[model samples]
Target: MQNHTIYIRTLKRAEHTVFCVEDGQKTYYDPQFKRMLPYASGQQVKRSLLDSFCDAGNIKISPTTFYWDFNKKKELKEGEAFGTCDPTYPDQLIGGWMKASKGGGSRTLKRRSPLSVSAMKPLHPLLAGVNKDSASFDRSGHSHNKIIVRGEDGKELNEDEINTILEGKDRSLTRKWIPASNKATGLFIQDIAIDLRRLFSIRLDDFEPEISQEVEEKLRESGWVEGENVFGRCLIAPVKLREKLIPILAYAIINWKITSNQARTFSLMETLAVSIGGNANKIAGAIRAKLSEENSEQAIPVVEEQVKGIDTFVTPTAAGYVATTTESIEAMDDAEEKLIEILSSYAYEALPEFAL
Candidate 1:
């Protein structure tokens, strides 16, 4: 296996070894020191840590924890570290190189046979910045970039200060790519026209007002419509529950403690994220916290059941939703798979073969 020593510094402290060596693409991150150094990658990490490992059918996407540890007041020395492929993915690849002093890694993974080096041009003004499309501080969901700002005891500065470091003077935080946050914010926020047209779109046999009077009456009673109609047929909107409902529900799901079950954690963070906007989550979380504190029995069991019902791979269910405009968000995940397939097959197929 090829060995490379990357200099890992503590910014204000002395340097030390994070690991000896192993397999896979691994980096040593001392959350305390706020530094990340290349520890190892590929098969080097995998074979060293994992026994009886295999990557059959190419099912696993090995994005594992390049693990390390730190005491509240002590430094880390040569330590053991490892990562697994995505846990959801079954079957593992024998990653990293096979030969000790030669080239080999991921025999199962076809080395990127780059037909020709090419630059992927941006669809917009080609502005470069950090991307930030996450709900939390890069804790989970998609692995985004994070700047580990070490405090006296390893506490990071508040998000606003960290964001300021990332954004500099750009007041347009929404449009800015925050590299420190490791988010994909620079992706052009396309013309609102796209979402607007989608919003106003009409599909076949979806909702017809004239054919439905009773429905309108129900909506009226639900406090959804406050507008006047030309025919005085003020049979207007439903409670607009879907917009703010699920997020608020998800907020309850997140902070709603299930002390009864002793389940401090659950999958609501990802499964519910699809429908819950940040603002709604924030509001809902506050409300849920209040409600949860008041009633012990009702709050605990309800949260446990809600969490148990979630499917991170599928769209989450919420209680109060009556109308929705989007397609199966499954479209998003499918498109990702399609993109990867296209890149691996069609994009690379025409490339000139590489050296042996």
Candidate 2:
């Protein structure tokens, strides 16, 4: 069984809007460090990864069953027919799922997820910055709700004539505005968000022997054989699943669009490094060393240039040599293509009737 650790550096390209708020503060304050830090929860990152996979057309399962929680009993209540949960579905097998008991019984079945995601946090405290400002908007406006006034002769009357005729009635013009509290400007509300271009680190770790042997036995009964098919191999051996998922996750990280209550449209994150089967602390230490080497205030550009020059490197440790690669977009794309090919092969071989 092989354990792989992936290290990624994210650059906020667009406005990283703030969602968490506490006592009118949007940023998280670490008591140990005594500073407010910019952070993204691991759940958010995992959701984005799942969303990327669901959005991809390479998977045969419906998107609803792929990402969202599905309950057969709940669907039955709505008078909709739904199939039983298949244990061999790629998402269920890799990402894991839960089968809740009916009527709050105690027979809940849950598959533990083998994949672990770390919260996206700042690499260094110095690299993080918070925008402590408020946004103001004018909620005051005017509108003319025109009324069609007709005369007794069935002829439409002009605006002036209509106003004259409806002198005692309500006028078509309407004006609305908030009462100013000793101020002429509109209302201002405060919200905190992390500044753009801040460097953050996220780690993904995959563990082997994810599912129980009993589950594996059931899968084998359903035509799954170790080393025989892609899905089957991934079911019995987690390393194969990790190889297929890591690239897709890399792509997702490069193109993660974080959904927020704030009106932000795009994600500005860029993947700086992706180190597999290596120590994240060592990778992060290397980056921190590079950043500290230069005393210049603008260290991100210099480090980025240095990292771009790095294609592959080996770290010698007690465990042995660990291969690390800072993948490029082209390399990641090629890996994704290879993953699609593998999945297509599995689809064609396992589900011949649904093969395209």
Candidate 3:
């Protein structure tokens, strides 16, 4: 039988420890509680310890399955390391042709799942000339838009509550793209959730790998310089590299979008549709489709027209790849969808996964 393990996380320091038993017992002695406690799989256990542990919050425990490898060895400073038998990593024979030659690198095994597309937050390029405030203006570039998030009780939220809602308990779930209108003193704030989904639609799969690699090398070389301050070890880069690299970076993003596997997740596909559309009217249609109760039909066209004004300031062509326009994104034809799916598979190849 496979082994199951439990992890106890201290509330105070948020430190975690692992525990396993020889028998398949459901209970264990908790050092914090100094007593035995019942536990179940997938449930969180929280309890207070003795006075010595007062500095921390109640101890929390979660049960999880453990994978291990007995045959392979790993290098560790203090002791020998071991591999994991997690399903995320599946071992397999090398290709049949390579097996005949006994190629050293022929046999391979899956190591982990790819990272979530959202995990590439740092890599997502900032849109050109589209500052936070630009999201608020009508198509004419007038500041007339905002996003309102109401509480469960339908009451307006205070700044703190708004922050809490936007930056939820799980920070990863929080929205990454924030528009300027959200900072204003009105009901409208940036709709980050929608923004994140829209990001999936920008088609970057066709971006030339060689060009991207060259751009990265050039940016790293030119963007960094040694400087002197309190110490001689300071390095400098712009707070926003958008101004310097926006032309190339934005072009890359406009061409990248979610792939087929990603589209399998219906919500992701819809978000890509809206983001690619880049038109408020189209996005509102997506919103209406996703959330039938809400109607964004009126507000969307205004925002769409507003963004069109920026066409003069931010022309997307850079490198040889042309920028994806709202109309192009909105097309959602069979060919486009197929291309997005294929590209998505390529993108997923670049991420790592873990078993939970």
Candidate 4:
């Protein structure tokens, strides 16, 4: 019942990454800002978090629970129903869900997500722009003009013989010339990216009434008593639920991945600086101050400075600073343990009821 509204701010640095696309180009034009900004939409950020949470095994909920639409008449095993199918389903507390009527009626089932993700924006105005690069599809060392066809007799057919056999056939034989390797060189690409060590901001806010009355009624009908089950009580108490979800969000951001043309080969970002807090401006101010320092060597120091005299939580180690997945996971584990210890110190009445 305490003020459940919580605002989380983070500053992250990524390089050579494009967060969105338009007209086959990896950039977005922000009309409000009247400029081309390196940006990621809210939907993009939320989807990444949901996917990361599911992939990392941090949350028990399936990705489909919050995203998939289900047929009411279709047979579903236990826990197979989409979160929207049952309001009381625990995962619905995350992204929420909506299902439209199948018969083309006006009826619909929907729940507003308690979590709000802001479109990621540059912390410094100078951080927004495009980076020019090129990608190649090189097949130079191999033959570019050979077209070997297998005949029905299991023998290779020469181009002349194949053409002669299909002399009058218009449907079966088709041929096109392949450009020489020199002429088929790759083209340049423009990506909206941050190449410098610049800071960017993203805000995640959790607000009041985390669960709807309809959902509460459904939970009661299912024999769920408030304060009995950790899940149930957490759902009813927005602050507690927010605390439980903090680690998952932290993991997602630290292990942040996005849609990029070159993601398959390697991560686009080389290094990152991150901090989390309930006040967006304060966190940004602290980050700016730290970055302005002449002798600062690392980004984690920003977190340390920001958390002073504030209800902010700094990940014990900067998972974002690690180079490999194993290191990232280890760092996150350390962070989660530290967070639990911090929560324990507050002596929240519900602290012992659940393992956040």
Candidate 5:
């Protein structure tokens, strides 16, 4: 709600007042979006422009975001201020280059900054119901506003069609975590209908506090004092980064299936443990003990012969995470139906309202 609600775009000398953008580039300039050059209606300007703007496409187009600032061409005295909002201000300015594509594009609210609006809180349409006072301007209203939009993805939208999405007319849904491959171009990975249910029930502000806390803890735990905050959020400490390489060598052995190597046994165990979300030391210890237990009989060798490494399966760029091997991802996908079936059974078990 604190981003890009009201904008003040700069205007060229004689450009048309209204127009629709295509993937960041303005095209077929018109009256709906752009108001009369120096004089125009803000409401008519919004409606007409939005009508042609949204629809028939996917993925949000980086818009020729509208601004209201008019540069004073009149000669200014030495100490005169041109205007409260100037074209020079970063928020109001748009570069000469950059295309604005048209269509049904996503305008996902990614990040937000602490910006203040007078009584008017410039916000997303989804925010209208939450604060209607300053947002709604009737008879005795002061109409000062501003908006800042950034995302050069160059997709356009048609507001007429967008209304259906906001209106809840299309109430049917897609599942949560539907995967990147299944999503439509402009559609987010999670289906909106499903995801909104979570939003309605969750406190969004606290959703990611652990992300920052964990990264800081990992940094301090590593005993690296300098640049601690700098690299706090990375998965692993910067100094211990090379230690992650130990897993790749261990990974090589797994793919080759050289289970007899006793020295690398701990490494292999540690590597797999990390894969399944366990600490390295705990995994190494568990692997050694498990191997020893299975080898109690003479027929069962202490060396694990069946443990084959799938190297070509994945390419590891960093140590902390495994970029899924096409082979592994494929194998997982093959069994995904069963995996989801199992997961779906347990999905609601631990969820809130289970007792109710």
Candidate 6:
């Protein structure tokens, strides 16, 4: 098993101590810090001050933070900083930071690569802004040059900004490569074409009669017609007709074009809405609030008017029939069914397949 070390910072210390969790307990050991105070178990500390003890992963200043030599390491002083030397990379290596042309700016850039020492040519014209590509003379006489960089918006950049871009920490402009999985990419072309043909069948049902006739005529004119099966019909359709069908199918799915079940569900929801003062949200909330009470008999008349025919019972009094409480098993079951239809419609409408 691999052991992970946790680094923690103290309020007064400049350096952090390392610790690890073992057997559900955390422990630390550091000679310097231990000289003042020693480590303890969780039971020894109070719960109120536990947050301070568990605080870790904070960055701090120290000479050991950077590499001072090939093998030796040292921390930077309070006022000190570290950076790459004059010859930042290998002499033969191409592409790195270089100074800009005269009068362009005092700062360096990482735009263009250095030229070979043998194939000598004058870069004066380029420096004069002929093609926006030029080279700067290095004091070390090395054949390496810096690449000029621009900001994310493609605007001109300064040295500091260009260096940040070269560091490649920001990946906003980078395209992530997704590897093809066996289950998806391994499908045969013929199989995929068949599935797409079935999908096209589902899509084509939404087209208007006139539009479908027009598409059929166009397909026949282009030497294409409906095949024996959906997949065959899909294969038979011309590219132009296929293109025409896409938007129509997309529109139908997006707007949820009047299916029988959807129409019935909408009617039921509308009926409920009208019965309970024409606001579903307010009515649902009111129903829930009223049902939560110990004796909700009084709230029955208002709710029953909405749910009676759809999900509850209608009681007939001496004068006329009236809707009463919806607390009964039959009424509850009916409400549940209606509510399911309403919720399913909402959920289906919110799906990406129905999105415009």
Per-residue lDDT of model 1, residues 252-297, tens digit only? 2122211111121111212211211112223223112112366432
Between candidates 3 and 6, name the one with more favorable lDDT.
6
lDDT of 4 at 42: 71
CA RMSD of each candidate after superposition: 28.9, 13.8, 28.0, 12.0, 29.4, 34.2
Alpha carbon lDDT at 177, candidate 3: 44
Q: How far is candidate 2 from the true structure (C-alpha RMSD, Å)?
A: 13.8
TM-score per model over all chains? 0.18, 0.49, 0.18, 0.52, 0.16, 0.14
Worst 10 residues of 4 by lDDT: 194-203
Q: Give lDDT tens digits, candidate 3, residues 1-356.
A: 11111111100000011111122223434463243332222211101111111222121222233334344465333322223222111110000000111243322222121111121110001110111222222333335535456788998777677677767454332224434321101001111111211111111222211112343344347553333322122223332332222222222222322121211112111112223232334433222112123542212211122233111111111111213343342332432343233233322112223357
**lDDT comparison, 3 vs 5, better candidate:** 3
Q: For residues 1-356, could you state the per-residue lDDT of candidate 5 as single tens digits?
A: 11111111111111111112222112222243231111222322332222222221121323344433334876443421221121111121111122222331421112211111111110111111111111222332334433222335645435554454448564322212221111001000000011111110111223332123343454456552322111122122232332332232122212211011222111221111111101223222211211125443212111111222201112122112212323233422222233222222222112233233
List the candidate numbers ranked by lDDT, top first. Answer: 4, 2, 1, 6, 3, 5
Name the top lDDT candidate: 4
lDDT of each: 0.25, 0.39, 0.23, 0.43, 0.21, 0.24
* Residue 73 lDDT, candidate 5, scale 0-100: 75
Error of 3 at 196 (Å): 19
For model 3, the local distance difference test gives 0.23
Deviating ranges (above 4 Å) for candidate 1: 1-94, 98-264, 268-329, 344-347, 352-356
* Local accuracy of candidate 6 as per-residue lDDT tens digits, 1-356: 11111111011100121111132112223342231221222222221122221222121211112322232356543432222212112110111123333454433223122211111111111110111112333334444544445667988788787666659575323233443211100000000000222222212223211123444455456555444342122314344434443333222111111111211112110011111112333333332212216543322213334432222322222012123443343432343344333322221111123225
Q: Per-residue lDDT for 319 in model 4?
A: 47
